[model samples]
Target: MLAPPSASPRSVPGLRVPGPRTEPAPGRGARAAYWARLLPLLAALACATRLPSFRWPLWSPDEGYLAVQARMLADGGELYETVVDRKPPLVPWLYAGAFTLFGDDSLLPLKLLALAAQLLTAVLLVSLARRRWGDGAGRTAGVLYLLISVGLNPEDAQAATFEVFMLPCTAAAMWCADRRRWGAAGAAVACAFLAKQTGGAVLLPVGWLLWRGGAARRDTGRLACGLGLPVLAAALLTTPTGFLFWTVTGSGAYASFTGSELHVLVRGLINAALLAAACAGILPPVVRVLRIARTGAAELWLWLASSVAAVLLGFHFFGHYYLQLMPPLALLGAAALQILPRERTVRALVASGCACAVFLAWGLLAPRPELAHATRLAQAVRADTGPRDRVLFWGMHPETYWLADRPPASRYLTAGLLTNYSGGRDGPQVGEKYAVEGAWPVFRREMRRDPPAVVVDDSRGKPFAPDRVPSLRRILSVGYAPVARVEGAVVYVRVGR
Candidate 1:
C-alpha cells in the first residue's frame, strides 16, 4: 500500500515537482540598502572635512609654489626652461589645465578638483574591499579612508598638492589589480607616478600581484606598454633632457641627506611622533588586522610596506607625505571591522570619526602667521607695481607672486636653490659653506636679461640678511630703494617709476 501511494506521483510521466520556495533574509535586504546609501554618505563626509579649504586662498607652501609654476606653464612657459621645480610634469600641467578652464587665482576650482579626486579614491577603496570581504567591510573601508586622510594637519590634507592628486591613481591601480586587469593597473600606477614620484612605489605590490596571479606573456607586455606610455608622452611634450633632469637627476640632490647625525636623530624622533599621531585614528582596526585577520592580509601588508618606504624615502616626513599610507591602512582596517561584533564596530568607527573632526578643528584654529605676512606683502607689492611690472621674491614665499598677480622676473620661483635652504634640514646655514655651483651665475644672467620692477626681500635674516648676498645688495643699491616695510618683508621698488 505504501509503495502504491509513492508511485502515484513517481510513476506519473511528463510531470515536474517544485522544490520549497526560498526567500532572502530581511536583514540581508536591509544591509544591502544600508550599504547602497552609505557610499554617498562617505563622500559627503569627505567634502565636509575639506570644506575649510574653500575659504583658504593658499593652503601650503607646496601648493603656492606649484600655483606659480602652473601659471607659468599655462602662459606657454616650458618646464625646467621657462619655469623650474623639482616635481614631475603632470601635476603642474594639471594645474595649467585647471587654470585654463577656471582662470588664474581661482582656488575654489582647485579645491573642488581635489575633493573630486578624494571621493573617487574612497569609492575605489570600497570596491576593492567589497570584492575581497563583503559590503559591510567595503563601507567600513570607505568611511575609514575619508576620515584617516583628513586626520592629519589641514595644511597637508586640505591642499591640492601632488600627494592629494596621486591618491586616486594609487587606489585605482590596486583595484584594477584586484580585478586582474594588469594593463589598466599598470597605466594607473604610471599616472600616479606622474602625479608624484612616490607613486611609483605602487609598482612593487602591483608587480607582485601580477606574478602571483600567473599572468600570461601578453598580459606582461600590455603592462609594460601601459607603464611606458605616460613617460613617453611626457618626454615628447618636453625635452627628454629637461624632463629627466628636473624630475629625476635634479631631484637627487634635493633628496640627499644634508644634515648632521644629531639633526637626523632629532628629526627622526619628531617624525615618528607625527606618524603615530597621524595613524591614531585607525589604531583599533590596525591592531585587529595585525592580530586576528592576518592570514589573507599579505597583499595589504605589502601595499603598506611599499607605502612606508615611499613616505620615508626623502626623510622629509612632511605631513602630506603620510597620506600615502591611508589607502592600504583603510583596507586592512576594514577587514578588521568585518570580524568585530556589531556594537564594537559602531563604537570603533565613531571614535575614528571623532578623531578626524578634532584634527580638522585643530587645523582650522592653527595660526598661519606666514600666510598673513604674505598677504600684507602682496598688498604692498600690488600698490607699488604697474600691471606689466615683473616682481622678484628673494625668499621662499612664492605665494606672493601669485597673490600679487605679477610675472616672476626670474625662472627661480623661490630662492631655495640660491640659499640652499632644504626643508626639514638644519637650516639655510647648514649648506652655506658649499655653493650650489652655477646657481649664482644663472641668477645673474636671468636678472640682467629681465630686470624686475620690484624685488621683495622676504628672508627675515634667519641664515643671512638680504644685504648679506653681495649680488642682491648690488642690484638693490643700483636702481631699487625700500618703498614699504609690511610685516617682516621689505619691498624694494625701482626708483623714479
Candidate 2:
C-alpha cells in the first residue's frame, strides 16, 4: 500500500484525491448574479438623468389640470362629481395618492413619482427582453427604452401624462403573458386600462396568448375575471353613469374636434417614422423582427399594431400618444442587436448612444415658453389672492389655476366648454348648439353661486366677449376691476368684496 501511494492517489468511500486546481466556469447562475447587480445600477442611472426636470414648472396644461384634480381629491373632493376630467378615475386617484403621500402643494414630489414609474417600466422591458432573447438583448432593450422615453419630444418626454403612467402596467402584462401566467397578465392589462382608456388595446395580444396556451378555457376564464374585477370595483365606487357620460360621450365630443383622420394618420406615421429614424437603434430591430416570424414574433407585431391603432383612434395625434408604441419597438430593436456581428453591433450601439446623448441634451436645455409664462402668472396670482379665495381663468390656461393655488370657480376647468360653444373651424359643428347651450346653465349656476375673487382673463389680452355670454360679461363688469396684468393675462379683482 505504501509503495502504491507513492505514485498514485488513493480513492476511498468518503474521501477523494485532489487534482490540479482550476477556476470554475461562468454559468447561468453567474450570469444571473451579474444581471442582479447590474440592473439596479442601470435603473438608478436612468432615474438620475431625469433630476433636472424635478423642479421644472408646469410645462403642460394637461399635467397641471390633473394636478389640480388630484389636489382636490386629496382635500376630500369626489372625482367626476366635484372635480371634472375626461380621463379614467385611476390616474387622478394615483395622483391623489401621490399628493397624500407627499404634500399636495408642490409638483416636485409628483414628478419624482412619475420618474419612479418610468424606471420601473424600463426594468420590466429589460426582463421581458431577456426572457424572449438573452441577457445582451435585455440590457439593450432597457437602455433603448430609457433613451427613447427621455428624448426631447416635449409634451411626452417631460410631463406626467397618462401614457407615461401606463407603461409599466403594459410591460408587465407582456412579461406575464410570456411566462404563461394568464391571470397576472390580464390583471396587469386591466391596470393599464385604468391608467388610460386606450390601454385596453393590450387585451388583443394578451387574449391571443391565452388562447394559444394549454388549458385555454380555464386560463381564459381566469383572465376575464382578473380583468373585470378592478373595473367592476371602480365602476361601483364611482357610479357608472357619470364615468360613462364623461369618459365615453364627452371624449367623443373631444375627439370630434381633432384634425381630420387622414391628415392625423399621415402626420402621426411620418412623425413616428422620423422619431424612429432619429433614434436609429430601434429601426434595425423592427426590420429584424419583421423578417423573422418566430414563435413570439406575432405577439410583438400585434402589440405594435394595437398600440398604433390606439394612438390613431383618438385622432388627436399628440406626441405623447405615440408613447404607447415604444415598448414593442424597444424590444424588437434589442432583439435585432443579438443577431449582428460583435464589431457591427458595437458600432451601431455607439451611434445610438450618440443620438440619445444629443436628444437628452436638447431636452434638458430647451427653453419652455409655457413654464416661464405660468411662473409669472402664478407669482402675480399668489401675491394678490388668499388661500381661501378662488380664481377663474377665462381661456384655455388651466396651469394658472394650479400654480396660483386657487380653486376653480366652476367644474369647467378648461375653456373647452366655452370654446366648443363658440364653434370655430376646429370646434364643434354648428348643429350642436342645443348641447352646448345645455352645459352653459350649469356653468352659469356654479360661477354665480360661488364667484371667484380674482378673474384672470387669458383670451390673449382681449376682454371677455359680451356677445358670446353676456351674463358672464355683465357679472365681471358689475363685480370686478383690473388689478394686475402679467404677460398677456389680465387679472381682475372683485369690487369692494
lDDT of each: 0.77, 0.71
For candidate 1, the per-residue lDDT at 491 reads: 82
Per-residue alpha-carbon lDDT of candidate 1 for residues 1-497, written as tens digits (9 for 90 to 100): 01222233223332222122255433877767866798679778988878767757988878888888888887779997778777788888888888888988777788898999999999999988876766677888888888877766678788998999999999999989888888898899999998988998998888888888897898888888888898889877888887777777765445666554466556556655654565565676566434533335677878889999998887666778888988998887776666555665687678777777777887777788888888888888888788778999887779888888888998878766665565544453434333344567777887888789998888886553556667778888987888777777788888776
Q: Please write out the lDDT profile of model 2 over residues 1-497, one tens digit for every residue.
A: 01232333232222122233254544889777957886787777667556555636655777888888887777777776777767788888877887888877777766777788888888888887766666677788887777777644655666887888888889888889888888888888988988898888888878777766765678888888889888877777887877776666765555664434565566667667646755686686446433542324567778888998998775666777788888877776675565554454566567667776776666677788877887788788888889878888876667778888888887777665554422122322322242333466777787779888888777663322333556667778888998778787788899996
TM-score of each predicted structure versus truth: 0.88, 0.85
RMSD in angstroms, all models? 10.2, 11.3
TM-score of model 2 (CA atoms): 0.85
Q: Which segments of model 2 are wrong by more than 4 Å?
A: 1-28, 257-274, 292-295, 421-438, 461-471, 474-478
Q: Model 1: which ten-residue window has the lowest total lDDT? A: 1-10
Q: Give the TM-score of candidate 1.
A: 0.88
Candidate 2, residue 199: lDDT: 88
